[model samples]
Target: MARRRASNEELAGLVQGEQTDAVRRLEDRVAARVLGDLESRFAVLSQRSITAWVAAFGSVQAESGDTAALRRILSTIRGAVRRLLGPLGPRAQRELDQALTDAVLLGARQHAAFVEEATGRATRPVSGRPSRGLRRRAAAIGAAIADRRDRALAILRPSRARRWSDVQAGIGAAQSALPATRAHIATTVNEAVNEASLTAIDHQGAQKLWIAERDACVNCAAYSGMVVAADADFPAGLSWDPNQRGRGKALAAPPKHPHCRCRVTAWEEGWAPEGVPSFPDSLRREARRSIARGWSLPTESGAARIRAARELLRTGAGLPKSVEEFAALAVRAGRFTDRTVPTGP
Candidate 1:
């Protein structure tokens, strides 16, 4: 009986370890491929349009000739957008084209209509050139935008929803395998250390962390990387391919705050990387380090932070008590406290 019980525990650990390794390996492959494509796309957009847009906006602020200024500003804005979202081909183009077109065309038409009503003759307000050419260009641009949006919208339902569903399903399938992965690790650990019995490492919480980091990867400018729940057991860096570009770190203990189910996911550029008002780097640094330190949550403030984290995670910010319960469990896990923060080059 003792032998059987030992076998069962050993089996569980083996299973957990295998699942962790396999999922981590597979996730690395998927993330690298997908994120690389997106990064290339974003880099292209950011590089081409930002300069001209900045110039135009800057010129306008400096009180350049109003008409020329308006022309440059409008042209810059239009060009920037095209540079950002220009399709790779039919493959990437879809419903988003229509949305873009609808918005751009609707805007251009509004401007043209206003211009015609006021000036009577169709002429460029600033250039004295016939407005026909400009309006035509605007119309074309608008249509292009709309076409892109349309394409995006059309495929969006299937591509995005389905992709997400598939990943989630993959996550579910992974749950059973975690024990296998952990078992291997447990055997290895058991040989050397007898600290604690291995339990389900925060698999659910890891998924949540993945989801959060995914969002930051998509939208956050300063995104450095993700710090996840202590219980969630994020894939360790040494365990993964060193070639993967992302930075990963382990927390010392569970989260101290409510719904703070995970630790901080830092972006390299910090928040508001699109040149909007941003948080102070020092403040951000301090906040991340402080959170990583694993102090107990200060009742109300901790609760609010947890709620905010949930909101950030898009988990619908469930009841405060629920978030708190999860957070407290994390605290008990003793995994949240210490972590290394990587500064990206």
Candidate 2:
């Protein structure tokens, strides 16, 4: 048998250098400068654009199994935006789309990891505590409703609606997933960031950011993205001063409803990479200051993380090994497919 040639250290280093450059190229993603929301969060859009393209590719290029075909498929999707963006537009779009797609896929891999972890820890060694405060509200609401029901019965009246939409309003505090919560916060933060950055942020982009935040808040339980900050609102002109990784943005309770677990996070205009265009300090300090908020929980009984873990594992086995796999599993088990997980009535 012929002996295989070994790669020397210098060649290995050069190869590693090239690999790193290629990877960094792939990882670079920029959200559109558009002001409006895209259909979902920036991250989810990032994931979905890639997912949809990849799925389309998988469907179209089943037997050939060509890796180049995947890139080409992504190229095809990028071509449509080229009119508005030019040649480099495709690359940026590809990066954003691929990020979202990869995130979902990695999330599945984490699902499998979560399953591996689940058989051990009795409870996740997580960040925030599940609030006893939520139960207090639920009890308070339930009791008040019950008293009304009792009073009406004594008067020979029909029991008023037990399923009042407002009754479970306080349940948002019950949700405890970290990654998912982070996604929610991340989506919102991205929006606020864009608003803070772009002169004229695209409306479609803004919508996509919201969808991403909602989905993250309600779906996966990995990272608790919701670190409620001191501000409730944000203005445009976004910039960051590095250190966004462990940085915590101010969060506030959403204005929409009482049970609303929706949260908004705000960052200092210079919190990210230096030289990125920033919003006005008025946008920064005084006008529309975002606030901090409470929590996220299912209205109905939340499936234990263990159950969520089990569901993740069962579906994540082989199929595409991505969000679709999880989605398929959820569908088979009769679970709802929430694109924007931070769902509202």
Candidate 3:
């Protein structure tokens, strides 16, 4: 017998799995690079700090310590640390930006190929300029690193004793901050991959998308069967879109939190089944009620409006009015807030 072609649902599931794996691998690679850079820099800085401290205060007893000499030593250590870390900000931003861009573009191409194979339609390649979200995410990573560096500086401040013990304690404290810093960078990579995947799906002309929650946690379970239009805002605003609040204020798009395993799948109009039994019934009822209460529809525009309304009914949000509006809302809701980004050191 001839080999059977996979159904649309099967293809979507396969793509989702593959995309998740790809993103995870990319994240791992990036995280390793970041951690390595941080470790190397920290080790060198710590050694230099120790050498400077030993030369300045190794023999001086606490009681006989010259205050001015201690100040000069601390200042030298601070300057050395600052100089060593200065290049990290730009390096990290560049690494993250390049990695995210490459991952997203690769994801877009993968989505386009799968779409073409499943539909037997020749689809256009995603040809737009780089996503602005990439830039914003890069800047966020830079800011996070700066904040961590500041904290490390605070920890390194010389105590009144100016003893060798004090210098060693400060170095130890700064080193202890590394694990949290690594986790933060890892989370940034996770979010970038998600944003890129979603962008790729949209560029492939998908009409609908659905969240495939990891289903391992309460938050993920609540969002498990949620679906949205290709252009609908994710993590739908709580004040303006109360319906999506069921997923929780903390839940907005995939990678809802660090180490999130959720994925999104896309569908074209005819490829997907009409009935989505998995969707929550309460939301459907609310959508219908909302449409009923809206302004009157024009007779000529009735069919189009009805289609839009039906889409909203299914997804729990109106179809995005325009691309610009969708982009704005997606960025506002999908990207991480300052509080979510980790501050370590």
Candidate 4:
């Protein structure tokens, strides 16, 4: 028997799993590079300091170490760290850029293939070139890495120390800082990769997209089954950023926060599984409720207005009628106005 093809949902899950692995591998690579550099620099600095101390005191023991020589050694180590920052920042950025480019292209191709399989429509491959958004995100991550490195150096710098134990304690502190930095790199880079992929699919002509939550927590669970137009902004009320509430521009797309595991996928009409909320059905219900209630659309908040427009569109009547038109009509009539809505092909 011929093997049955995987369903679209299954394909989406597979894509999410693969991308997660890719992100983890990229994180490991970056962490290794950073820790390796730190170790090598510290080794060099330690060797030079030991030699200088012996020459100054005519002995290699910590008891023979002169205070002035110790200060000079600390200065030298700090200088080396500063010099390392120049090269390290660019190297980390280059890694992030390449990783994000690979991830976006992979996601775009996978989504396009799935769409073609389900809809019998062809999709062009996304270019591997880095996007402006990707570049900006990479630069931000690079700056963060530099800042963390500087902080780590500060924590690791030994105070007026005459013994090896004091220096070792500082080194221990530096090592302790790496775990948090590694976590930060992973989450930030993963978010950038996901955003890039979503942008790629949007540019490829997806008309609608749905959120695919993975092991969702309470916050993301509320977004489950939500669908929106390809180009429409997510409802402001659903924004993860508190400052973005009521602001239409806060989150234009999915994976709204750092380390958000939710994947946004192309949505096909009539393809949602049972129990999944259909956008049209939900919109119609909202419209009916709004009409039944004496709610002022014009005075309603932005979130309310968006909800009203979506409802109007679902009733097969709101076409050519923008959100503003719907709000104005609601204000004039104090009720929902029924009109013929244009259906998409």
Provide the lDDT at 107 for model 2.
Answer: 25
Model 3 misplaced stretches (Cα beyond 4 Å)? 1-16, 32-37, 40-80, 113-125, 159-193, 196-217, 235-252, 268-345
Candidate 4 per-residue lDDT, tens place, 66-183, comes to 5666677666656665665556667666666666666666556655555554445565655555568657866675576567556646644545355554544444444444454555
Candidate 3, 222-321: lDDT as tens digits: 3444566767745532211233334445333565655665555455556433454222232233233323222221211333223433344345553334
Better of 1 and 3 by lDDT: 3
Candidate 4, lDDT over the whole model? 0.52
lDDT of model number 1: 0.29
Instruction: Give the best candidate by TM-score.
Output: 3
Summing lDDT over every window of 10 consecutive residues in candidate 1, give the lowest-scoring window.
Answer: 191-200
* TM-score list, all predictions: 0.25, 0.20, 0.56, 0.54
Order of candidate numbers by TM-score, starting with the best: 3, 4, 1, 2
Quality of model 2 by C-alpha lDDT: 0.27
Tens digits of per-residue lDDT for model 1, 1-345: 011112222222222233234333433442243223544544454354345434644531243334554454334434433443344222122222222233233223322322233223352211121133223422343344345434433332322323323322322322222222223222221211101111111211221112111111111112223334434544433211123224445423212111222112211222223443232233233232223232333322333333333333343222345444554444455343322323232
What is the lDDT, from 0 to 100, of the residue 204 in candidate 3?
59
- At residue 144, give the lDDT of candidate 4: 68
The RMSD of every model to the true structure, in order and in angstroms, is 27.9, 28.4, 14.3, 14.2
